[model samples]
Target: MDVAELTGTYTYRSFLNRPEPVDDFNKLRFAQLELRLTAEPDGTVSGELVFSEGEPGGDTIGMDMVGRASGASPFAFTLTGKGRPGSPVADFHYEYDGVILRHWDIGIGQLMTLAGTVLRAEDHGSGATLARAGQTASFLAVKRQA
Candidate 1:
């Protein structure tokens, strides 16, 4: 699938805990975020994100990314973001591969989930499958600063 057409705003929640190196930290919660995404024909996606609830950390994150896919194959993407203020931005990438969308003989049986959550596949009138785990189910958005 071409990455250019996949562009929209999404509302989401962000949950996080301190890494193993550090302990006793609180589990941070970021919710009710208004995130927008724009994918380009050249496999690049760029956009901005804003939060409507929780904390201000998610108020906006910068995202300049890319995704690649071949016919009938699962799509893959790489995205990164930086929180507002003193928040440090991080870069992460994941691929959606070998997904199955089965219903009455696997009509559209293959799906690709990015980073263990986001699901992308052929929207043909058929049943869809999560296929594998580790696919991110949430679409995150971040804005670019001028």
Candidate 2:
């Protein structure tokens, strides 16, 4: 997939980490993450992911993705954010798995729950996956039209 394929807004909900309140998904309510990515021809990838609903501290954290990716090679980026008292950053890695861009952040403890799958719109369909701490909860997302 390419930049044009990724230029859209995607909203996703994840039931990460268990034992709270299990829905039809069977896992507890974790949170919802919304992403908007703009890929530039100049090889600059930029996007933001918003966290809401599950816990505190998510809203205070600001995350922005900026990186580069090539054919078959993984998309490598840095997520700079106000994760702490002073702004800190983490590395994000994603790969196009033929179907979706499976991604994960370096993860700074409980600071950021940043791992998910992004599926670009194709002939078949578009969707996503949300997981946390090696546990993949159920997720579904849609691409909004511009």
Candidate 3:
């Protein structure tokens, strides 16, 4: 399918594969995400990602997103979104790559393979070379029907 075809809501889930079992490792392992986006003809992207974690009535947070799609066959894309807002201590930087599987019958819903690194704004640029790097994770999500 084409990137333009992905203009709706999708349920996204990613698994963390970190070498060290840090305190935040559990966060990535036990979260469910929902992405609602509109793909423009020019490849512009606008969306919001809702993340739910913990128990049934657990915490849920929203992130604002804007991105662009590239390539034709694989429909690779880059998304830059912010979560937690002005609260520096609670904020996060999300960066990821996504590829909608060419085949649909392989998984539960429209299969999408995703991988990316998530870090704090401070853990960037030349200064960050000495600081600890960000965390990386990869997983698959299925696009749900409208």
Tens digit of per-residue lDDT, candidate 1, span 65-122: 3344222344454444333443332222232222212224454542222222343232
lDDT of each: 0.39, 0.42, 0.63
Q: Give the Å shift of residue 3 in candidate 2.
A: 2.1
| Model 2 agreement with the true structure over 75-114: per-residue lDDT tens digits | 4333222222233212222222112345446633322122
TM-score for each candidate, following the candidate numbering: 0.39, 0.42, 0.65
- The list of candidate 1 runs beyond 4 A from truth reads 14-30, 53-72, 85-146
The alpha-carbon lDDT assigned to residue 22 of candidate 2 equals 47
- Ordered from best to worst TM-score, the candidate numbers read 3, 2, 1
lDDT of 1 at 117: 35
What lDDT score is found at residue 50 in candidate 1?
46
lDDT by residue (tens digit), candidate 3, 11-127: 776676656667765565734688777888888888877764435785446677788886487777777767655332235566767766566665554444443444333443345
Q: For model 1, what is the error of residue 10's alpha carbon versus the real structure, in angstroms, after optimal superposition?
A: 1.7
Residue 96, model 1, lDDT: 27
Residue clash pairs of candidate 2 = none
Q: What TM-score, to 2 decimals, does candidate 3 have?
A: 0.65
Model 3 steric clash pairs? none
